[model samples]
Target: MTAVQQPLAPHEREMIRDELLRSLTKLERSLKSSGAAARPRDLEQDTVGRLSRVEALQNAGFTKNLEAREKAQLEQILSALRRLEDGSYGACNGCGAPIPFERLQIFPETLACGTCARG
Candidate 1:
């Protein structure tokens, strides 16, 4: 009998998780610091206050978006973890077929085979 291959093995998941965690950590720090850094200056207090307000708003928006994406990615990783528990990690979520190992290597969070993914 021929053995089927995993789209992403344990090592691959660990690598991707490391990358995602780094990005998420960086984004979190930026989000947390943007408002603090936007405080008005003493020399140009009036203009600085206005600019700070705008900067704070923009930073909040970016942080919100980044956080949302990060949460989604985390969920995807969690699903992958569950699949590992169930022995179905590499199967496409859409059509229940085995996702190609190559595709999983490139995108560890993949939910479908290429054909199903295209649709």
Candidate 2:
């Protein structure tokens, strides 16, 4: 039989919520500043040398990838916040198990517990 797990304490929930909010704010600012770097640049031969153009293209690609990752993380944070509001924040979505407080402390946006996440 599976054991029942206790829900998160109010203070613990508040702490995690605060951390998630802080992360959301930081990521939003980062995404805003990185928007220009991810844009396509003018790669005309006369405008920029071949090597410079290649470097610019590579940099843009890197920036785009970074922004994509940040955007995904932002979404995860938002989802976690919603779960918090709905009284489901620390519960694993897969099996309805309580995610360990230690794990939540490290990954406040996670939706699954370690076992379910690995599977």
Candidate 3:
């Protein structure tokens, strides 16, 4: 069953907006970071060095993937911002109807209301 929604206070909406902005900024920085390695050295410490480099590369890859996902979500949030500017933020994208304030609170970047989104 759908829960009743309470409209966001100005402070709450501001907090979510700030969070989205921070995430976007972090993602942008992550995308610009120098990558894991330049060249693998063929020195005597090859085993340990290569292992450590491989681990670092794996971690960087995971971080990059996560940042990309966050970036996409932030883009969706920015889209919501555009909708807000146009005075259409709370309306469902699929149908001409209001989106529940609760849904928006939980997922401010959502474009579709629960009903339309389910489909």
- TM-score, cand. 1 vs. native: 0.62
Candidate 3 stretches greater than 4 Å from native: 1-48
Measured against the true structure, the TM-scores of the candidates, in listed sequence, are 0.62, 0.90, 0.62
lDDT of 1 by residue, 1-119 (tens): 11235445668656655654565566566646654554543445555677686776686677667656756776776666556556666777777777776777677667788999999
What is the C-alpha lDDT profile of model 3 across 62-114, one tens digit per residue? 76677567667757867866665555666676775767767877777787889
Model 2, span 18-74: residue lDDT tens: 999999999999999999778777688887998898889889889999999999999
lDDT of 1 at 106: 76
Which 10 consecutive residues of model 1 have the lowest summed lDDT?
1-10
RMSD of each: 5.8, 3.1, 6.3
Question: Quick one: ranking by TM-score, best first?
Answer: 2, 1, 3
For model 2, the run of ten residues with the poorest summed lDDT: 1-10
For model 2, name the residue pairs that clash: none
lDDT of each: 0.64, 0.88, 0.64
Inter-residue clash pairs, candidate 3: none
